[model samples]
Target: MAGAMMLALADGGSFTLEWTHSVEREDWRETWEVTEDHRLHLTEAAVKGSGAGMEPGPGGHFEDGWWVWAPDLPPVPALTLAASGETPSAWTLCGEDCTQLGATSGQPVQVAPCPDAG
Candidate 1:
């Protein structure tokens, strides 16, 4: 993530990334936290309804009109969300403050924990 945008963690080092699925047109959300090692830890995820590429993970259950589950994937260095510029709404990053991003065409947003400077 060198030379990319750097965002300090919020008080609890937790945040959520939200966006509308392009094919499903359904709202999707992923809750993540910054680990002490400066890696991104995805804790949970939810989607309005299942569709192409919207399959819920095993053990997912219905709750409040959403299919929610905890993905068992390992921590990632970073996550990238591509922008088509045709989305009705901007991708949202919510922590201490909410930021709308990647609404422009050809612009992509990459999210990662701020790594320690050496």
Candidate 2:
């Protein structure tokens, strides 16, 4: 799952949403910690139901923060909210909604498509 997420992030124009469900007992104490390493630490927890939540980790940090939840939580397929590029193309955001930022494809594309052959 982590590898898949990394690939999505590499695109620099994608977002993911995950849902979870499980039983939560009173004794359950969920402690979702966001380490400086950018890895999610989903501590003790119990989903109980279709509980949905989204956490925005430290932004701008290419390698920082994470999202964590209890293991009991239901395995919700990751949702690709949006994926836009400089090219005028439609992206598949899956079930997740998307909002474009800035104007004119936003920033420039980093990589070049190698010299085109005539």
Candidate 3:
């Protein structure tokens, strides 16, 4: 499967990210690619979890920057990610207790600064 995220640029030149992942077809591992003015590419692959819903609990991990997980689900406010997964069509992140985070598409998944990186 394939998905994309749009990067809004001030110069009018937008950045785009493309990703592909699959469980059955190992031919294409879960990976993300970015393209923009700066010439750089990431070849490493990461397992894009294939699951759904939150697990509920304590602290967790998350990526940086302001993000919107799902516009359809309830708002989660500012917090850490407890669990995350990719469905057949979209990416989702949730707090430790698996509270609802709105549906996010064509946009950043974790907008706030990533906690795991720090």
Considering every candidate listed, which one attains the maximal lDDT? Answer: 1
What TM-score would candidate 2 get against the native?
0.18
Model 1 lDDT tens row, 1-118: 4535566783238888999998779999999988777788899999998999999998899999999999998988888888789986688999878988778886578887766532
**Model 3 whole-model lDDT (C-alpha atoms):** 0.26
TM-scores for candidates 1 onward, in order: 0.86, 0.18, 0.19
Ranking by TM-score: 1, 3, 2
lDDT value for model 1: 0.83
Candidate 2 lDDT over residue span 25-99, tens digit each: 111123333223333334333222322333323331212222334353332223222233333333222213543
Residue clash pairs of candidate 2: 21-73, 21-74, 22-47, 22-48, 23-48, 38-64, 38-65
- Which sections of candidate 3 miss by over 4 Å? 1-6, 9-37, 48-87, 91-118
1 or 3, greater by lDDT: 1
lDDT of each: 0.83, 0.27, 0.26
Model 1, position 22, has a per-residue lDDT of 80
lDDT of 3 by residue, 1-118 (tens): 2453222222112222222323322121211222332222322222223333322112322323211131222222222222233523232322222222323323334423222221
Better of 1 and 2 by TM-score: 1
Judged by TM-score, which candidate is best? 1
